[model samples]
Target chain A: MVPAPSPTPMGRPSPPVPARAGIGLRHPHVQRLLDERPKVAWLEAHSENYLAAGGPRIVALDAIRRDYPISFHSVGLSLGSAEGVDPAHLARLAMLYRRIEPTQISDHLSWSVSGGVYLNDLLPLPYTSEALDIVCRNVARTQDVLGRTILVENPSAYLSYAASHIPEAEFLAAVAQRTGCGILLDINNVYVSTHNLDGDALRYMRSLNPESVGEMHLAGHAVQHIANHQVLIDDHGSAVAAEVWHLYEQALEIIGPRPTLIEWDTRVPPLPTLLAEASRAEARLSEFRQTRIHCYAE
Target chain B: MLSDLQAALRTGLLGRDDAEARAAVANGDGLAPDARIEIYRNNVFQSLVGVLAAAYPTVANVLGEAAFRTVAAAFIKSRPPRQPQLSAYGGELPEFLAALGATRHPYLPDLARLEWARNECYFAADAAPLDLGLLGAVPPERTPLLRLSLHPAVRLLGSRHDLVAIWRERLGGGGRAQDAGGEGDHYILISRTGLEVQMTELSAGAFTLALGLKLGLTLGRAAHAATLSEPAFALEASLARLLSHSTFTSFVLSDPAEEVRS
Candidate 1:
């Protein structure tokens, strides 16, 4: 039997991701996706998870990469580090990028590596000008090595730095404006960080330079009590919360539509449950496109 | 200044909570600075412990959730991962468990070793097994001088306990472990063959041969080692079973002159 043609052919540069909703490609879903071929607009992969040279994940990713546009969402970039981005990590990422050719790549606007130890969590970064310089330097260095622009995502915060001079959105905007990178506006993080830090969610959303955003992420967060007040924890463990979904709709209005993603990492349910979340985001993106079309028609 | 603040925050989260970190953070939305740092502290520890749980679910199953979390938290504090790739993080866990809980739970460490080996084999590079049929090309007299290379994914784990049986039982393989105790020495040969990891218990003679070969012993010398352990060791049977599944990647014919003679 003749093999079916792949949407994105091998050996070509990665094709751009469409302005629709996709899902984070967790390990459990890789084989199911191959067998079922679910209709997600694209798949976003954690770059570190797939760096092994020869493994089941790598093999599946090669087959899956042929059929779907992939986005490389990395957690280890540590762009906010003052110690500089790890050169060895950068080289490994570069190797994977050359092989997979993902359409979009991203990391958080936070540091996780400290004193040469990977803490394995996205630790918050103070938005001081000094941090801004360090982040920009690290981001620019990353772009130079990877030979493509990377998107920096806003992090979910539990506390503010006494020294943070810039707002979260403006800090991300400046990172995009200065480094020639783009913002991967994570709406759930906006809700969690603002609600936790006493910032107005609407104002933070409006503060971003919408054109600088290349992609968007929506996920569920957990609310916990911290010293008599409610704090939202950005644990991608469940369905997108109603309030976060509303914030996502507001983001669609302000930033227009980008390649949105629904991430459910912690207690990742079955594939259909995740696909349903992605479809909801897809519906919002479709609605945004329709509204723009109507505006042009009027 | 940026590095200093980071160090303080690191100390607050991973190390004992420091007053400097609490002061460095801004108290907002009725949450104290220490409480904020606690939030991050919980995240860092919980996520890492979660990673260990995924890698060694059988270990967690054996220890139960609360006990495993305690052990995992202590392991995290002691030997935190230096690599960015979290997949490579918990390689030291088996040895760590042995050091901590050997007296209380003797079999737990060996069980962890088996799981860790299987994890490594899963990500190891794929290499096609050599066709030993090509042995026809070598002169019959020189067959004993041939040295073999095990596949990159091959790992031989020897324990006093029957880790394979315990692992099976814990993974819901049904029947209880009739001999899960440290009764006889058990050897496990683990290797990835074509996307699936194949693990089988090896006999004394077979394990000795594999270990000898892995330590660069020639075929004749390895057979000598195997026969030393088991008088009735069947070389041809074991060789056929191992070679059939691509256990060894390549073989080199060595000169008899290189052998150290008594």
Candidate 2:
């Protein structure tokens, strides 16, 4: 568990992920990618979904990893679990890491399990000092074990904790500061949380330690009407809303050019449609870069 | 506070009478306890139902979505997920169905077990088939005492009824429902090779032989076990059947001198 060098961009060549867009590699799209080797910067996979020993999922990942730089996005690590991260899940992830050698590793800043019972959904956590401390310790332990500074993404929430004290942005900053881990800012989550909770998404983005921000996630959401209350669900089953994409553009301004991933998990469109969504992000990044360069010259 | 906070959240989410979640005016939409509690309740049940569906698609198909949801709700209330990976969540559903007079799906448990085994085999590791090259190096006389090792993906199941046939019938694989009817016993050998699951009907003798080898029995002892289960069992034929199915990934020779590490 020797730590790989501090990933704080300490004069190392930024990893191989080109400052471009990539699509989340779902199981349905595996065969297409294997057949044609689609023209995306890299592919991202849900780590837990591919933990099989010798199945088609693993085989597909093996073949795709050779052609495209893969990022292992884990959902089951449960970094915020009060029970702490599951050890066997971590061991299985470590084994997969050794096998695939993904370019980046990431998990969400939410708890999916409690009291040894897994809820499977990324349940929201109460933002408080005690929870922040627990999350940072677990992130540090995970980084120490994985030998890499894993990226912790924000979770889309439906409700807020009554006993909470700290703000979500401050909590994320504190976790990053304490653990020396990086952030995978999911702009869709920020938009979903801010609009529903009535907070300033822009200021929330500004509060983060930009240096620690390594990657960005943009996904789709479904609006649910419960008693005339509009709660946006981060249901990755539709097109990326215009507002979230605008926030993604703003994120590019703050974080500069990081590896952006267009994630669509359920009701995934055809391979070409996903690639088209990723291309939109690519176009935005290039436009941002050109504008930044022209303004610098001026 | 840490553990208590978790317990309170679980209690609130599970909607148990012992919920420690303090009802506050600032919680839920418009801060209503029923609505707040309802949010968690919906999430818990919905998630548990989703896990059951993933683990038991055949059962879900058998019962359809509505009844499956009812059964899933009951299963969740009766037995929540104890493991982080939801793959292991529905272990008690089959037994639970057997006890509950309702639902009337008699073969649900065995069907659930079959789906669970399919998942297990799906995630099991890939291995090279038994390299007889090593066996070729072993001396001739001591080979009779060799004990074979079954692959991790190999599972032998014996039942008093045609469980696999019933499962196939539900899957519309052309198996008749009558095939599972009547009071006759059945044996099956399930294995995964080349990323696809393979299930073969096994005779009593073959099942005995597989069970023995799985338990580390030597060749002679495995044959004896098969004979005990089926008197007319032919030892050589059963051995050849297992080998042809590529069950043994490696073997331990009877004599230490003639042993070749596989």
Candidate 3:
């Protein structure tokens, strides 16, 4: 007789995702992933999109999970909310994580919900001591419930707050240091936020604790002119910018190789285009690995 | 101070006032603080509006893009998503549309309800259908005490308009609005079989039986309810159809001993 399903982790010993490049799994590309079963290292899906109890998408993801390691990249955890994490949301995510058994689980450092209203966009946070305390508490609570560590990604912001005394990188490091959580560094966000806010992207990259970075993300951003000033919006619509690619290489040089994901949420191109982007990231990762080996030999 | 900052940001994004929130945002090189905040406000509303459009394509198509945007923006402002799961966010939209009373087509609300039902069915939980052989094993006398549970994905919708036809037409089914004829009742049974969420129009008897079964009535009582609604209701045929469609997930025999204890 089949055993009754339990809420505990299945303890299925699946292979861990290699420190190679992967693609963000979107609904448009599910059938392609199923049909082709590409040679990519892993697939990351937005956790909120797959929170449904059951569907073809969930079924497809389950089928695909067998072939590739999956990562749950959440955009709606609202980790920076002052009111703390929502129990219901956390419970649902926990349920999903139990089912999917993702190789990695991550959300943004920014808050998306406040006062019971979910804005559905990653709003920037003021990196004050108080904000840091709240985020760390929320992260701890999240990790405690999921029974696993979650990586928090940095946000791509159009604006910063006057109240923020601590730097973004410092705040992220503090959260990791305090909560024992890892960081999923999105290189495009670092490039965009620093460019828009007039900070040094390289400096921010160097400030982060490399050991805390479990994964990296590379996505395209759109440059928009607001009030005659160039503002790069993290739209994830087009090809990865050359500048962002340069920064990714720089980040690899600093932080070493980690599991990287190519996120193209808006105007998602055909599977081949995303695959090509993943290939580009994989090539860089390989090149970085080779350079490291050569340097070690020398 | 954190609460104040978040409150100001909320007001700045959703309300007309940005003065308080603008003070909190540090000004960039050349862009005004409010302009920067405007980008976030635009993103928030646009993304939520896009979600509503995706959930209710028929509503968007019927209202047209410009009008749909107006409605979506209004809906977002009034009933912002309380939960992070956006797929389940727009369930209240049918009532909101009905309250608007701006459409020439009064059937729009029902169409929206149908779409929402379809959306719910699309994401509803998976379940295994009841085994016919299990029913065969039960003594014939005990069949009347068996309470069948509908599948989690099964949804019954009753509309005063020919909602199926209207929804199909909006989905490019090629039927004109007039072809739906005058107002008539429609009973729709939506269930997910494998990967597909299938919608079917149920007969009066079958609808009554399904509705009764959903309400926790036993098989004999549900058949009685079905026959009461439609004299020609054939219990065997309806049972066969429901079983074939994988409507009922499982059933429990209502024990006389347990009933007495209760």
Candidate 4:
């Protein structure tokens, strides 16, 4: 068995992000984050947004990084692509990682590119032996290059492939077991996929290895109609759905308190609105923490 | 087999070869496989259209949303982004616009070019400005041998139409397209200073000199080129202006041996 690679040493020792709620950092909220310095536990930035050589966004992130521990959530890695990972993209990410030294880093368990054409959407993969082998290889290679174990988020799939024989939870668990990477369990994604595919969200959550879950994502999804059927779209445009929040509470109960993030990308509300959402998650986290403390005392 | 599946999916998402690809997807939940794939198809086009709209705001403003979406969809079909970075996706859009034959609006291509340059300038690499003292330290006699380097954020755009006027009007929230006046050649200089990317209209001679310098010409050669283009070109004044704008990042004394070999 190949030994897991050690975590890459950042230039300076980064402050670990607390197991509390945070908000996904957006461009419009940069000023508020800097000026007001909100009381969120941390900020999570899309790794691809800061890949540019220079920009106000990069500068803003630099200032914001000083005040809060950051997590780099990437969408462009295409970890499940059959072509494997692109070396150029990896190098660009490495450059940004070396500069920012984010506390946590992650990408999705979906493919976005094939045959050199990047679709820019998290397309689902067939959960067969072929795909599992490819994903495990890609995850291992990415960890080896980044010199750190990255958290792989489960994709909010729109469709299922006919060739998929393995369950999604088992595939993710197997990937983590092989690559020594953690899972960035997206609760909203599970809710969305289950609603669309007529599956059991709670069973899927229960199937995951709780120790392998390092972070959790809670985002707003839109509901759309198709042939008089309701399908949830992971648009991240509005407030977190009540059903998703209920599922999130259940997840906290099962997975324990993790670094949860409130992701509102499209039609993003004012800073206070996102903060309110983060506050809701933080309330639940605090409740769980208090319960655990009381139990230990007893 | 994975490659074939991806190929089929790509074609299907673009609304081509739907039947074969739809068969690969499991159908259930009262939604046809084709309808399910259509969601991704619409999303792929709409999201990419949004990217182009954001990058080329003036173009989208000039063409209006519906027409802009039409043109963007065509462009995406013809030239999808190969890289994952969307910011660097639309480099060929100006050429695409030219090929689209917007003969009525002749300046559309140039306006798009300007917008593309601004898009690039916004994300160009950062570099420290060269110390003016270094240029001052060079002996007057050896100044002619000095080669100046422009910042990565610097871009020069020469257009036959008055693109700056059209871009300015659209950027200022002018909903209606006004007449851009008579056609005349324009020289524009784009550079990022501090945090803001600034666009300035430059004289023909200044543009010539900047272009020459960007091509690795020595100060003396670039000045000669500038004067050749415009007899009244003031080399000292233009150099002062360029330096004040922080256009150049560094300078070096050209190696005589390398110069001779070239």
Candidate 5:
């Protein structure tokens, strides 16, 4: 019974997010962003953060959106939910996108809702065709509602399922082919999931078609020893780890270059620290742009 | 099959035990399925609890970290967010506190209620304030039948505890707590402007009138209810004060169909 969202603010869409590094538009740095207005290429916001009906935060986002191109990195779409995506959540997202006219939008490859309960973490899915159908159905429905295709990111999974038969990248590539969505290709998540599941990270990347990639995410992860076994948690609380940074460089070499975002969600450091991390990503992206880069073959 | 697996996984993550969820998972390289499922359980709890902590910081402060975590863990396990928006996740916490016999502080539930109200008001829908000048032009006879629509971000909170003083003290404004033993019921009006949430204590009669209007009663009936609740309720002064606070959003014109609406 939800009403239709208004048409996209601009009859024609604004320019897409630039192929350069962008920093996360977090709450703590909102004031500094308004006052200082740094020269970052673009800004990415967690869509759920600005979903309020009316508030100063919403006002701030409106003002900031005027200054920079934005991409909404949504976590609540829950594309992998077994019961299907929540209609209300999808409708709300559609409204927000129409209002903001974000350059691009995306959600994780995992599920967070089951039996009407919303689990906060992005839990992994068994890479089977049945699950693939559910994901495609959800993604298609979302795209139909938004009137645009969205990219799906690889999630940092803590567990491996024996029922999972299809390889991770192959599963993603299949999703892209079936749903017309693109891959987000988080290098840190690639490292974290592969490390936790004892899979080959490079081999996983090799299965994905480089052309299917539309954007990239790089974030810091925490290494922890649980029950005498080491697992890398994609906490997004600190700087992009050295291993993740190296993985990001290799991804740039493979994927060519895309709108890369540096996400530091947890112990969010100062603005300069985040901007510095973004500058590192910017430097690498600039290097890729300067060269005769060929995407990695599947 | 995916639904059954996800259902079992839900039980695994939020249930008291993960036996069913562990059975659903495939065992690991150098790790058992139990340990793998346990990892997700830990992640789910950590993130969900973090959401609750942010929503109910004053409650956490009053209860201290360890006790608050215990209540939060129990509350979230039983009541995982119904919606994907974690911002709206912790609404049932005050009721949950009362149900748990979490009587560490007598005013804890009311304080938690006030906090939830503030949270809701902060993020509620935005609407422009009703123009008093326009309303004044209405004929006096027509005014009695006019129904007022309350602002989206306005909330009327009634408690036995002096929540404003307590909230201020806990927020480190250095306000002294008032003795509430014989103070009767407390009515608080909460509305937000910009990032600041303004809290003003209201009289019993004014609260009654505001509550009636919020519940869709016409102005005359709402005022009548207010005066009946408190025989000394002053309508003129209370109306002026509520108007100054921008409590009402607009006046809903009567529809013939909803005319019979109770």
Candidate 6:
């Protein structure tokens, strides 16, 4: 039998990840993160990356978590799966969350499993009462086991569900309200899905209840030309496009301030590149706050 | 609606039937349902394929990129991933290799196993070395009676063929050339010492003794098993190696009921 995990470190949880620009702590940058401890306000790590019971990487993360607030982002939760959440995966995640004591924990709003098979990739889910019910229960159960409310991230999508009753923002808002969880708003996903499906990205952004949003994500994507039709790919490899940055600025305008993470998962560039992207996000947040102060004074 | 809704979502992802597929697709312009589904299908295939490719780079090299992907897709489809972690995704590849009718190379399965072990050791837990001082304080009479504790990262593998040589050829300093004349049964001890994982060949007796110790055998019993396997085995030297390698993180007397466990 697995031993009960070490308890969450007692104390005030590290101050919530600042509502400033942070970076996703991917492996390529682990050493760099330790060595430089760049000026980024906080860092978020993929939960599965540190699932090992022990290792040098785990040790490094343990050390880094001491200095930087961490947000444990999960890709494998399969929150929208018809099958119940994978208990082993949940247990492992719970164990890691306990050990890390991250300021915030999050997973995607997508399903990765079907017919007893895991796709190992985030799959799209329909927006219906049934889908919403499955997602809400899973979210609540996940939060219960982890002993904390988690932020469910909206996924980048290429397809839509015909039987869906609610709009995407409403679906997410409903999940947040029903489950008492929060949202990790991935602005790139909204932009990508919006561009791919030809919808108003700003409208989707405006519809989300800002107070319920726990965090925000900013990432870069690629434009894939498929058979003369262009699809925006959430590749997270290249530089954040100007339009997404603009959308992020718009989100900052509406949402006020929340923890923002600059994600660069694939085609990861040098550490400086990620930090630069994060710095850009920080500047935007600073500008947004300054503008709010000016408008209020006026 | 909860479980059934989840089931419907799954059916749509698997792309099993068009009616379910149609229901899953978004009717919004610019993105057709088939196209959206295709995007997801590609993402799923690409991600899992990347996991397999990482786990079996040599296999991928041997089969070439396209062929490896073809085989990986089939293996994945036939044997769906049970574990959410991608590191745990390819445990069945060795068995799959054994049954894959089109493999030009017969030894690929063993190599895949070696790579899998490498990954396992890479991600296994860290452990401190057993305290030599504590073991030294043990009364000489009970020293041999003490049970040795292996690190959680320890793995002992005994293969029927010279898969060890094959692994070394692909990965070792000797370079990548198969030695048909070097074929023989082989044993191995794989462990992690920091971030890097390494594999070392072991004698049959040493391997058996280490395996026994790993299973929580007392030092005396494990040594006895080692001697039974090979009369000329050196227990002291092996213990010293394990101690130096930091493989034995802790030790205890075989009898847990006893108040004095040291």
- By TM-score, who's the top model here? 4
Clashes by residue pair, model 5: none
lDDT of 5 at B30: 69
Q: Rate the local accuracy (lDDT) of all candidates.
A: 0.85, 0.78, 0.88, 0.87, 0.84, 0.78
Worst 10 residues of 1 chain B by lDDT: B173-182
lDDT string for model 4 (A1-298, tens) is 1123224354457777778999999999999889999899999999988888987889899889999989999999888898999999999998998888888899999988888988888898889889989999999999888878899999897789888899898899899998888999999999999888788998998888899999999999999998898889999999999999999999998888898999999998999999999999999999989998999999
For model 2, residues B125-212, the per-residue Cα lDDT tens digits are: 7877788688668676666677888988887776676677677676663434544454766787888767788877888988998898
Q: Write the per-residue lDDT of candidate 6 for residues A1-298, one digit (tens) a residue.
A: 1012233577555656878889989888888878877788989998877777777778888889888988889988889877768888899998887778888888988887665677777766768888888899899889788877888888887777666777878899999889888898999999998887666888987888887898999989988887668999897888889998889888888877788898888888899988888889888889988988999999
Candidate 3: list runs displaced more than 4 Å: A1-10, B139-142, B173-182, B255-262
4 or 6, which is superior by DockQ?
4
- What docking grade applies to model 1? medium
Model 4 CA RMSD to the hidden true structure, in angstroms: 2.3
lDDT of 1 by residue, B155-229 (tens): 999999988878877876244454346588998899887889888888899989999999999988898999999
Error of 2 at A5 (Å): 8.8
Query: Candidate 1: deviation at residue B132, Å?
Result: 4.2
Once superposed on the true structure, which residue ranges of model 2 sit more than 4 Å away at CA? A1-15, B22-25, B28-37, B101-103, B133-141, B172-183, B256-262
Give per-model TM-scores: 0.94, 0.90, 0.94, 0.96, 0.92, 0.90
Q: Write the per-residue lDDT of candidate 4 for residues B117-191, one digit (tens) a residue.
A: 999999998888779998899989877778999989889999987787788788876754554544677898988
The complex in candidate 5 yields a DockQ of 0.68
Q: TM-score of model 5 relative to the true fold?
A: 0.92
Give lDDT tens digits, candidate 2, residues A1-298.
Answer: 1123233223432246667898999888888899998799988898877776676778878788778877889988888877788888889888888877777889989887777776667767788788998898889889878888798999887667677788999899899888888888999999988876777999999999888888888899998877767778778889899999888888888778788899998788999999999999999999999999999999
Write the candidate numbers in order of decreasing DockQ.
1, 4, 3, 5, 6, 2
lDDT of 3 by residue, B1-262 (tens): 7877887898789856889999998874568898889999999999999999999988888888899999999998889999999999999999999999867878888888888998999999888888889988999888878899999989999887888777777777243665354566778898887878788888789999999999998887888999998899988888888887789988999986754564
Better model by lDDT: candidate 2 vs candidate 4: 4
DockQ pick, better of 2 and 4: 4
**TM-score comparison, 4 vs 5, better candidate:** 4
